[model samples]
Every structure is written in structure tokens, then in C-alpha cells.
Target: MQIRRVLAATSAAVIAATGLVACSSDSSDSASGDSESSEQDGPIRVGTTDAAKKAWAVLEEQAEAAGLDIEIENFADYSTPNQALEQGQLDTNNFQHLKFLAEYNVGNDSDLTPIVATEIIPLALFWKDHDSLDGIEGESIAIPNDPSNQGRAINVLVQADLITLKEEGLVTPTPADIDTEASKVQITPVDAAQTPSAYGEGTPAIINNSFLDRAGIDPNLAVFQDDPNSPEAEPYINAFVVRAEDADNETIKKLAELWHSPEVQAAVDEDAKGTSVQVERTQEELQEILDRLEEAERNS
Candidate 1:
């Protein structure tokens, strides 16, 4: 991906206006639902946060060649796609990780499930005010405010030795969980969408890869990056999401197959440039994580 791709990632105002709707929970089979029957006539609608049309162009061509109809709709942020999927506006979505979807379900009382695993885009701490971690001492640092990724930002800071978290095994630590006395820098929380803009405010902000990519920042320059293969990163693997009812839908299963195909994986790797690591997990493991996250979210 190039500068233009970054521009596309951030260019959601035009699409958001038209694509985002008040996501309802009523998924009926009246052409709007994920009914296997509804997939017989037209292209299956898929949702993503960024415009992945180019990223999946090769896959799209291949799907077309195989007589499979699919269309990807890009949204502005994380919240809308699951809502749209639950409400039957989209056949499936591939924008979020299982933990994110689980959190969404817990928050909304919806049960959108992940049927296929995609890739893990590791979270990294990028700084504009400092060239090295040592220079970040005593500075006010910004991190993502969303519950799902907030703990991740904190974990990166912990890995960087900037702060210490009070809890032993917090899956989603908030600012309240920070051990201020032991911390070297002041921690501030802001919306995940605002993390990119949090920089240059006399503070180094910890930005996620999705937003960092949108800002066109070089991933290699990140002062610290989380290991995507670590146990902590298991919840962050992206996936194809669908309503619980469509878990067995043949078209959706086929779409997942196409997405995980070697050709498509190669295209994703070529375009992602080291930003995303392709991954696949057993369905049982994915479900177990989902169940655990659901329990955690409910408890939280």
C-alpha cells in the first residue's frame, strides 16, 4: 500500500454518510437478511472499515471467475459493521478481530460471530515528539480509549518499560489500571480514532496499525511493537464475521475459503508490506476465545 491507500483509509466521510445506518437487530429474510436463500439472486454484501477493494481485487476477480458474487462495503470505523451485519444490511464483515466482535456483542446484546480468521496487524507505539524511548520520560502519552484495544496500548507501554500495570492478567486494562507511582510517563486516554491525531501535542501517542496505516506512517519506525504471535495477541487476529445464524451458510463459507486462498493471501502480503501477518486458527479455538471474551465483557 502507498500514500494513496492511506488517503483511502482516512477518506470515509463520503462513504460514511451513505454507508452507515442505525444498525438494528432485526435480520429478516426479506432480501436484507443473511438468508442462504437471499444469496441466490445477487452479490453478497461484505463490510470493512477501510476500503479493501484494491487489496482484494485479485480475490474479487477470482471469485467472479468462479461464478461467486461478492461485494465489499467500507465503513468509517469499527462499531458500524457488526451492527450492520446483525441488522441484515451486510452478509458478513471482515474488519474486526474476535475480541472486538465479542465486545460489540456484549455491549449491544447481539451475537455476531467470527467464522474465518484472517490476519493480525500488530499494534505499535509510534512517537512524533521523541526519536527514542528514553526521550519519552516525563511526557504525557496518549493511548486508545476503546476497551478492546486500550489494554493493548498499555501492554505496549509496559513492554517499552514506560509504565507498569497493576493487574497481573488484565485482558482490557483501562487508564484506571495504571500504577501511577511506578510509571515513568503520564498516561492519557483518547478515542482510538483520535490516536493518530494525538501526536505532536507535546506527547507521544501509541497508535494501532489500522490508524497508523491510514496516517501513512512507516510501520518500521515504531519505537515498540507487540509480538503478534504472543498469547496477548491471540484476541487481536482479524476475521470474517457473520450473524450466528449464517455460520453454516454455504456462500459465506465459500467466501471465507476464497479469502484464505493462497492467491488472496499472497495479495494481502504483497499489499500489506509487513504491516499484517496472515493467520489461521481452528474454529474450536476461535469459539473458545469468543466465549471467554464474552464472559469477560459481561463481567466488565
Candidate 2:
């Protein structure tokens, strides 16, 4: 979408210093703006966490060939991208899944919506000393502390039989919901970024795929992981997100659809090391899933 040009030529150095990379120079004058009245003539300022991945380069090339301009803004943490998108600093973002998006929208009273389904990266459990989930009774396992991911991590433990929840079929089980006496291991919640370090410190951790690559841990070495193809994994399907007002923008939709291009998909596969399960869902289907998740979040 065409946004107001907020950054002048002099700010390019500062933007680069903060990790915002422009995928194309054609729309250098276009950066940030109001989503309501703008046309799709300028660069689509897209925010993401994995901007360094080669898939972005491929997608940029594909978008250029398709007559669309996109700018990639990189954020260091998971929380900032959506906030940026909500604040109108970004035209769209593709960093989080529907569950996380639901939590953000419900918690903050925002209406950021998903436009296209991307891929589901499995959350895996890894350990430094143990090769299998055997004989690890009484030990503690670290999990992500964020609301959405923490629940998924708890589910991973439940699937591994290392822990059991007090209630059956809880969608987002917290550590408090764990049946401590009945469970084999204790639950420790930490920041998502520190999970690998927790693993390095001799604790078993359910690490997100983003941290595994940078930590030099092999995805194949994960002792256990949730099944991406299962029905329970529906909420974890990542997608391109935008404000509710811009959800139907044709240019943004076209840009989001480019993620499935053969060249871009290949780059994504190479970057994910065969661990990512690509997902396809219509915008209506995705909105329905998000609605259900948002209802759950509200009820919780």
C-alpha cells in the first residue's frame, strides 16, 4: 500500500543501523503513512523477524517481476512487528501466527487481521545431555513464557508424556494448570529468546525453530516435536497480517500471495531445513480461525 514517506534520505543510515532493510530502492521516498486513504503506488513496508532469510530476497525479486514494490523491516523481537503494524509504521507484517495475533488483538483491543497463510514451523524440545525423553523424571524443563507459545510448549510436554494437565483438552494450558505431583518433570517458563541458553545450561527446553538455527542446534536432534499436520496445529499456521482496514487491499493481497511462488518456497525450504510445513488456507478460513481464537482469548 502507498504510505506517507516518513523517512528522508538522511534517515537511511539510521534505519539500517536499527535493522530495517529496504528490499527495493525504487520506492525510497515511500516509508510509513496512514492506511485509510493511501494508494498502492509506493513500497509496501512489510515487517518481519526473519528478514535475513534468503526467502526475502527471492520474494523481493518475484514481487518486482509482478509489478509490486515491497520494503522489508526487520525487528529483533517477536512483540514489535505487530505493534509497528498497528501503529501504522508498517503496511503489513508476517512474523506471527493466528494464536499470537489473537492474543495481541484481544489483549490490546486492536483489529490486526491475517491475509494469507504461510507455513507452520514446529516447536521442538531439545536437551543437551539427553538423547531421548527417558529417565528424566524429577528434572525441570524450560518453556516459552509468552502466553501463546507457553501454552503450545505445555502441549508439547503433554504430547511427550513428560507432563499432564489438571484438565483435559485445555487449549492454552499454563504452568499453573500442570499436575505437579502427577507429572514427571517440573515446568519452568522463560523468555523465548533464552530457551536455547536454558538448554545450554543443562535444562531440556522446548525451543522455537527461529532460535534453533542461530544456536547451532540441529532440528533433527530435537528429542520431540508437535505434529504440524494435526488438527491441534491449526492455530499455529503463520500468515501475513495487516490492519482490518487494509485487509482487502488488492496490492497487499497480491504481495502476500507471492510467498507461495516456487522460487520463494524453495528458498524458504532451504532456510527451514525441511522442518517447516507449508500451509495454505483461504482468507475467509484464516479469519474464521482467528475469530475462534480471539473468542477463546476473550473468554479466558
> TM-score for all predictions?
0.85, 0.87
The TM-score between candidate 2 and the true structure equals: 0.87
Candidate 1 lDDT, 1-300, residue by residue in tens: 111111223234654477644222333542344445425335567777766535667767667766776666666766667766776667788888878888888888887878888899888887874557877789888888887888888888887788888986787888888899999998788987787887645558888777776777676777778888888888898888877877767777677778777788777776666677888886668888898989988988
What is the alpha-carbon lDDT of model 2 when measured against the actual structure?
0.83
Off by over 4 Å in 1: 1-27, 30-41, 129-131, 200-202
- lDDT against the true structure, per candidate, is 0.74, 0.83
Clash totals in order? 0, 1
Best by TM-score: 2
Quote the positional error of residue 188 for candidate 1 in Å.
Answer: 1.5
User: Which portions of model 2 miss their true places by more than 4 Å?
Assistant: 1-39
